[model samples]
Target chain A: MIPNTMKLFVGILRPEKFQLILASGIKYFAPPKNYDDIEIPERQRLRIYDKVPLYPSNLKPPKMQKRLRYMRGPELLHNKLQLKQYGVMATGGGRLRHEHFEMVRLQVARRLDMKRMFAIWRVDPPWQPVTKKGQGQRMGGGKGAIDHYVTPVKAGRIIFEVSGKCEYKEVYDMLRIIAERLPFKAIPVSQDIMEKMAADEKWQEENNLNKYTLKYIIQNNMGGCHRFISKYDHKWYGKYV
Target chain B: MSFIKKGLLQSPVPLMVAKRFRGKINVQKPRKPHFEKQLLIDISKPYYGPPKNSLPEITLCENINKKSYKREIDNPFERILAKECLDWFNTSKMVVFLHVNSISMEDKTPVFAALKKNDMHLRTYGKKIVSMATKGTRYEVINQLFTSHQNIIFGQPENAGKMFKILRKAPQLVVMGGIVEDRLISKNDLVEYSKLPSLDIVRSQLCSVLQSAGSCLVGQLNQNQQMLVSHLEKHIEIQNNPTNSDNLDTNAKSES
Candidate 1:
């Protein structure tokens, strides 16, 4: 059925799934004709990566996602004003394409967010060791990194993760199942805006944090775009956007 | 269980990001379908004496015909960059280490094609690759590719069943990773499980192999893992594997 301009909400999915979550109606494990098969509807992919409150000591990422949802939605929506959703994925690196499936985007991001949502699911990278010579303090170890469990990306929001051997859909479905089961709060967004954010690149640019001034989702101006980087490191703090 | 303005329950697993509305947003161009393929990223460990090769790594471009090159995208690109330096590695007459991940839900063909292209050796850990922990059929593709290689080692204890499928081709692919260390960290369960840091895991795996084929502390592994490795059939045996036992014992001694 052709869709109407219905304001919508969104979320990410968990990576693992129960044996029989879907009765089989939902699409699963279909081969793609090419890379174009993936898409994160311009609107649905309306997320701006920023380093807000890194952790939830007093403020957490969920709360941050919620607050940021409110802050960016209306303007981002350009007053069409719909809902938006944010899902996090635990990709050590950010590389999902601009056009992966909307479902996959939500699912993958939410799967990564699972570590942040629930501490039990917190799976740290298996090889990053602390070099600071301490029990807990690390070169990358900060209460923010641990408490937030996820680093916000600046420009990586465009790159869909292609790492490892999992198929895009398969990986997405697993996250969808998890999102279905996650207990984390769903921060409501303007469905209208969330629906159109990506397509409106010009408007996106208008709202887009100035490249030199504002740091973006996992965006790194340092030499090249690095992961887990921060505009917080820059001498011109909050001045670039 | 904190509820303030709305009725949002904070469970261990939150399902709030639900989209009861599947309304079709204006999709620009329809997404092109893609399948997962197996890729054998063969990196001959740096053991062939000094650094004879000019380039340390070779990354296959997204397009195969293109000469594989490398540029720091500010972080580790494509997860495993070892594939970039395959040329220098294979010809070096060195021990190649392939860190493999397989998921039952993926299509593992591309990875296989890449590995076969390099004419690389293969091995397994005799364990199951975690389908849940991975992204796509790509995991399965890698699984099938190496298992069918001329030399295969079943590194994953869980995937021991897949060992024969590989043994039928390759003589013996060296097997290591958590499988050798006896810890299987599935991505599915990693949401909350303990894993060595990514850097530490990478360092240990590479260092373990490079540092004198000796026993090493394998990725935050524990006593239980040690026992499991000791019992992996080949590690034991009073006769058929005496030489193997001697080396393993020496390594185990160092880890302790």
Candidate 2:
């Protein structure tokens, strides 16, 4: 079985994963506003959702003397709180200073269950906060200037590509649980499990009874959400009757 | 229990710290006044030190070299030291966190002095004149930390690890701590620290001989199972250095 990132991410965030994410930080993901269907290559799909390694990315990938040597059945699902936090903090055109990253470093490291885990960021120029209140009731009105940053990145969308080969089903269950429970709503639907959920009549009824009701469900969970309805495309798996 | 032991002995830095004060540190490092208690001792009415309190040297006098010279003991010093530490804090206090890992030269004497009087005040807060023990382990100090905090880190690695074992079984307990890496240290590292023959292992041995090691972990379960188990790590870090949390929000492209 040639393993892949999609399989890995699906396997970790099962229901039992809720407690970890609750403490770790919470936020799922939103589809990229400028998501391109054709451009994303096969290898880069992992980056689209999320992926963390047990070993340092910078370290040279060691040659496998024995395929068994590389076969540690390691797997992880991050703290839900962490995913949400990252979704809110990273998705928007916000730039996190170095130390802000460390606050959650311990949890992130533990999730990967590896020695070292690090991340770098590149932010697009964000919009300047409006100093003056908008006339009457405007979008960026009153309340201290609604600081907006513009980025090609999309916040509120969580996509994790977990790896390893133990209890992949549990991981999938965790992703579903984390997605629903996170503070920020990441479409409250999993691209990873859409196929399965679409096939499962019971799950579809529990999650998407009606076209508009499901929208409300996602919104109620995440409050004022914009689903990447387009991400699933014409072949939307969990399309309600 | 076995895991905790493995974690402790496997601590990143092995070997207990027995030295002290690398002289003063640069202002940049953690020169927090809290880390410099010896200064507090000196500035306040001569709490502890030499001249009159030296350990009796090997009895040079031939006549005195005989019999059980247990009377040369500075037993009173340790009692006085514990009283002073409690008094120094003013009002009552609990869980004296002596970093048994780090102690200084001047620090060693007080620990010995404290140990003599059965005092467990000093602990290593990173190699200095902070503290040490008679047998050279702050096991007693750790036992106290556990007694006071209970569900917090107990003295040994097994005790610490037991928390997670219990927590794994009862997730409602709300595990929390200083957030080492991301896992709460209270339940995380302390559990890891519980194992690995620490000063506690030696101290427990002594306590056993004295038939006095207290019952472990039973009283430590979380009655506050429903109450939020919060460790001050994240809130403190955010408050002191908002940027230190490593908040990565680069993907947020501003609404164009």
Q: Best lDDT goes to which candidate? A: 2
Candidate 2 runs further than 4 Å off: A1-106, A115-156, A164-182, A186-192, A201-241, B1-256
- The residue-by-residue lDDT of candidate 2 on B141-189, one tens digit each, is 3333321211222222223334344434333234344222222345445
Model 2 chain A: ten consecutive residues of lowest lDDT? A66-75
lDDT of 1 by residue, B20-72 (tens): 43332211122232221001001111123344455444542336677767652
Report, for all candidates in order, the number of backbone clashes: 147, 97
What's the C-alpha lDDT at position A82 in model 1?
15
Chain A alone, TM-score for each of the models?
A: 0.20, 0.25
lDDT of 2 by residue, A87-135 (tens): 2122211222222233223223334312222221222222222233455
Per-residue lDDT tens digits for candidate 1, residues A1-241, read 4334332211113334333322222223435344433333323222433322234588433322211211111121122221122223321122122223334445555554331121111111111111123566555543333222232222212122222222334344454464343222122222333456446755655553334433332244443433322233243232211
Instruction: List the global CA lDDT of all models.
Output: 0.32, 0.33
Task: Name the lDDT of candidate 1.
Answer: 0.32
The TM-score of candidate 2's chain A against the true chain A comes to: 0.25
Candidate 1 has a DockQ of 0.01
Chain B TM-scores, listed for every candidate in order, come to 0.16, 0.16
